[model samples]
Target: MQWIPDWGQARIESMVANRPDWCISRQRTWGVPMSLFVHKETQELHPRTLELMEEVAKRVEVDGIQAWWDLDSRDILGADADSYEKVPDTLDVWFDSGSTHSSVVDVRPEFAGHAADMYLEGSDQHRGWFMSSPDDLYRDEGQSALPPGTDPRLYRLMARAARCPSLSATPFLRRT
Candidate 1:
């Protein structure tokens, strides 16, 4: 990924190295559910977690996210239902935006299997989407999502333009 001012990548690297692990689940009553079953006693994912996720995905495709909330654990788990429970937490908002390459881009007919050529955003996202996307991609795909030598552009608002309101109509300034 390209950072226009060039230091953007370094800043993100430092943040990732120093930051604690991010939790990708939330307790919200609404949202895309994590959609997996876990062993009730061990608190570990069911051995068939992936298979269960696939079943949920099919239902979600046909019935939307409600499919997950409405699911009856017994229907899928049968006798195993006694030992496992569905994960109630929904995926954090970061999971949605951070995993767009897989959830959105990879599903498209034209963009499937291709990495994004560019990711353009304001400086504020450097700590949010900017860092989350690559981190998520690396975990999911085990490789860099952007091709080598792509433009590294980072555009930031000047101090007055970002914080101080002014009547002047001067264009926002940025460094090359």
Candidate 2:
């Protein structure tokens, strides 16, 4: 919740400038419905039917979206059947991105314990995945980048010596 930015006036300007028309229609039958309604006589979608949609969403979480779809007119419009009919379009992109990690990685045990040695990206990554991946890695490892009680400066020096043993050798060894 704290992650959500309050854009306020900036949000309105951004929306006005970048608001491309979104195709709300989808051919899918699964997942959350678009929560619109069409008039039976006029064959046009009703604009004010989102009030009923909020009520339907509460029921969907408990009983599933199919329950709303299969409901009679009385239940669909909740006592206002003359004005509206439920929209059948559900978002296809919902399943596309929603289950990415689970669908791609978790099902294959080979990938389960594996991790990327390094992630190469443009400078944009400094603000994007690079910032987030470390937090995820730390959470997965159950500790910080260095183990508890280990000084990072000392660890780096040790690592450097480990990689270049000549630097760690004594001057007396030069005679040999």
Candidate 3:
């Protein structure tokens, strides 16, 4: 963040420090389910959540979201299905989209690499999608995604290119 404005840095820092517990599940008819399996007695994730996640993903890849909506846990888990519970809750909007960088971008060869040469978002997302990025990347790779000296150029994506545009081509705000 050496190049980031001081106030921008501070604002994001504040939001990160006060962030709330994440909710990765939702109740909805149209969305991807969280694909989490829980121990029937403890309400904890099954020991093979990752495997189950992949199984669900493979089915989704072939049949689309309906694969999850129409799944029969017993067919996948076999006898263990009686001991674990498949959560029907869909992923929260934020958790689903916020994970795209890791899930989609990182795994797909064509999209693999730095998320972007420049990452720009409104101040409002500091605590939501933008803030979730660092931890999400680190959680998977054991290090922050933004390598040192490779900090993304922070800028706001403005809605316009210029103002008083009836006469001039000059932008209303140009970088100094």
TM-scores for candidates 1 onward, in order: 0.80, 0.38, 0.77
For residue 59, model 3's alpha carbon misses the true position, in angstroms, by 0.7
Candidate with maximal lDDT: 1
lDDT of 2 by residue, 51-161 (tens): 767777778778886767776767656556776766678754523332233333445666554333323223322333333333343644476432333221111124445
Q: Pick the candidate with the highest TM-score.
A: 1
Candidate 3 lDDT over residue span 73-162, tens digit each: 897889999999888888766665566656655466765555543545555667666766666657555876644656464554444632
- Cα lDDT for residue 96, candidate 3: 57
Report the Cα RMSD per candidate: 6.4, 17.5, 6.6
- Encode model 1's per-residue lDDT on 76-174: one tens digit a residue: 889999999888999887667767666655466665555654555566766676677777656545876555654445555566655655422221112
Q: Residue 80 CA error for candidate 3 (Å)?
A: 2.1
Ranking by lDDT: 1, 3, 2
lDDT of each: 0.72, 0.47, 0.67
- Model 3 scores a TM of 0.77
* Collision pairs in model 1: 2-152, 2-153, 3-152, 4-152, 4-153, 4-154
Model 1 score (lDDT): 0.72
- In candidate 1, position 159 carries an lDDT of 65
